[model samples]
Target: MDNLSNYFGQNINQKRIVVTGGTTGIGKAIAKLLVSLGGRVFVFGRDENDLNGALEVIKAKSFSGEILGISADITQKDDIDLIWNKVDNAFGGIDILVNNAALPARGIIEGNYEDWKYILETNVLGYIAFAKEAVNRMKVQKSGHIINIGSMSAEVKEKTGVIYVSTKTAIRGFSTALRKEINPLGIKVSHIEPGAVTSDMQEDSKEVQKEKIVSMEMLEAEDIAMSVLFCLSQPKRCDVVSMQIRPHLQII
Candidate 1:
């Protein structure tokens, strides 16, 4: 008999996915990859211009699956609710939730409290809030996948900035506990940690250093996309809890 699962194909093709911060950087890259693989993706962000620009890029990539643009800050519950409501009404339930939204880097002791708060709220709260909502929906459907974008900084502490590292570390813990809580219920939670990818967030003064990493080699956004795809593409009977990506040049 034909069913909702059948439509999604063997590896979650028709599955509905929500990608936060899906306008640029890693998020945009992931959204594009997922759509190309036949999964429907709804991108959420705060800037209309950036969102529309990303929409154009994704469209130009020839994504036949549903591509939606939602202009809403992940920090706000109302905005999150609106996006989820649209997804629920349109796709009934989400099969994948990629919490890829994160605030730009900021200093630890030198940075303002506001900056720190923003990072925590968006990087941590935003991901958790969406996961909470997605879990509720998935609970009813009896299955779902939650993939959080983590940083290598989570494991390697650096003098560069502690705020970002702290929150990412929290995510590592969160993903583990969240998985244990929901695994029995059939939901899968995975964390993807990438080391030093070329992104807008890379420091300008350290461009040469980033270039070395990019050259001697850091993982491309698509590499991370593939890592994420691997976690999602696992057989329904299998579960991959966590995996980290490190370039050959990277020591830690």
Candidate 2:
């Protein structure tokens, strides 16, 4: 068999990946799935305890590949630098970056400047900073992928949580422009927008969330994780620019 066809899907085996806010919820789920598929994964969160716990669980289930964890705030430049330094030493170079760290926003009228500032820094600027770092290395390799976890709230534009909505809208625009700017470098950018996922960010209780999931009124964090894997597994010629995933029964 001397076939020389170049058409093939991206294999996750041995791929170096960085996942932010990976101590819990969707980020953790994504990290777990990636590691299971044989991708070397580095995950970080703001809480030391959470990071440790997530690493424990992820490592236990990982049949192949490697996993590491660190506790650091994504909005801090020093923290990001520290993470990247460790990544360089551990993985040599990155093949993928998942920007997922974020804080839930209060109502527009509820918080003052400091509150809004914190959310903006974590949700908006943090993504940009991480992307910049990833691009620095990815451009040199001339191939990589950046997956941004967004929310459907950007388009839903509900009356409440205007701050969160605004940040998501900015992410939508940023992802579009980022793709255009970096696509020429052979790096792929994908924005995944999810709706009504049951996570720590939600106000609903565990029982309520479970019921909602049963009723298809909400999605599970793992659902979004699967979407991420789908995007990454595509062939290089096929770039999944953006994806919107919602529960079948969820409306809003």
Best by lDDT: 2
Q: What is the TM-score of each candidate against the true structure?
A: 0.91, 0.95
Please give the clash total of every predicted structure, in order.
0, 0
Model 2: number of clashes?
0
* Runs off by more than 4 Å, candidate 1: 1-9, 205-210
List candidate 2 segments past 4 Å from native. Answer: 1-10
**24-111 per-residue lDDT for model 2 (tens digits):** 9999999998888788999999989999999999888746878997999987889989999999999999999999999889677898
The TM-score leader among the candidates is: 2
> What TM-score should be assigned to candidate 1?
0.91
Cα misplacement distance, residue 141 of candidate 2 (Å): 0.9
- After superposition on all CA atoms, how large is the RMSD of candidate 1? 3.8
Per-residue lDDT of 132 in model 1 = 94
User: What is candidate 1's lDDT per residue for 122-156, written digit by digit as tens?
Assistant: 99999899999999989888999999999999889
